[model samples]
Target: MQNRQQSEIVRDILTVCNGSGTTITNVMFHAYISHAQARGYLGELIDKGLIENDIFDSRQYRSTPKGLKYLAGLETMSELLAIETRRIAKSGANIC
Candidate 1:
């Protein structure tokens, strides 16, 4: 894959939560992001109402419905991109 986009990173973060809750450390490791990057994205996600701090577990985070919706959209886009990529590769067409 090419350089990861912020949306992709956010989607990864949301997916990692699994509705149970997850920590910044978990997201950083799973998403292959640095702590600082995780922190920044976490804050942004919280502000956007896509993620929220766990009430019972202050250190953990849970995904909101909006975050799940966004994650689903990203998955769809990724699948479409993969299909296009395979079609181009089969046809020997340049993506550039």
Candidate 2:
């Protein structure tokens, strides 16, 4: 598999936890990150108010509204970038 950036990993984690929430194992598997990495990113995301652990069940983590908004914005940006790239390629313009 190809390597992913931290932001991409965060996005994957959010996507994996978007609905009813999931276990840390699920996040790790889906996000393709190690346990240590997941823990660190989860901590940062929680501090940023992007994701929250279930109060009733600590093992469960879910994406908050802010997280969803961030995911949407990121997706939009990716789409826009893809469109620009395709345009550039079609025009035979060198990006550099």
Q: Give lDDT for model 2.
A: 0.84
Clashing pairs in 2: none
The models' CA-based lDDT, in order, is: 0.81, 0.84
lDDT of 1 by residue, 3-77 (tens): 666766777788897579999899998777899999999999999998999998889998999888988997788
For candidate 2, write residues 1-96 as lDDT tens digits.
556567678888899989999999999998888999999999999999999999999999999999999999977776666533332455787543
**Model 1 CA lDDT for position 14:** 88
| lDDT measured at residue 24 in model 1 versus the true structure, 0 to 100 | 89
Native-to-model Cα distance after best TM-score fit, residue 3 in candidate 1, in Å: 3.1
Candidate 2 is scored at a TM of 0.82
Once fitted onto the true fold, the runs of candidate 2 whose alpha carbons sit more than 4 angstroms away are 83-96
Candidate whose TM-score is highest: 2
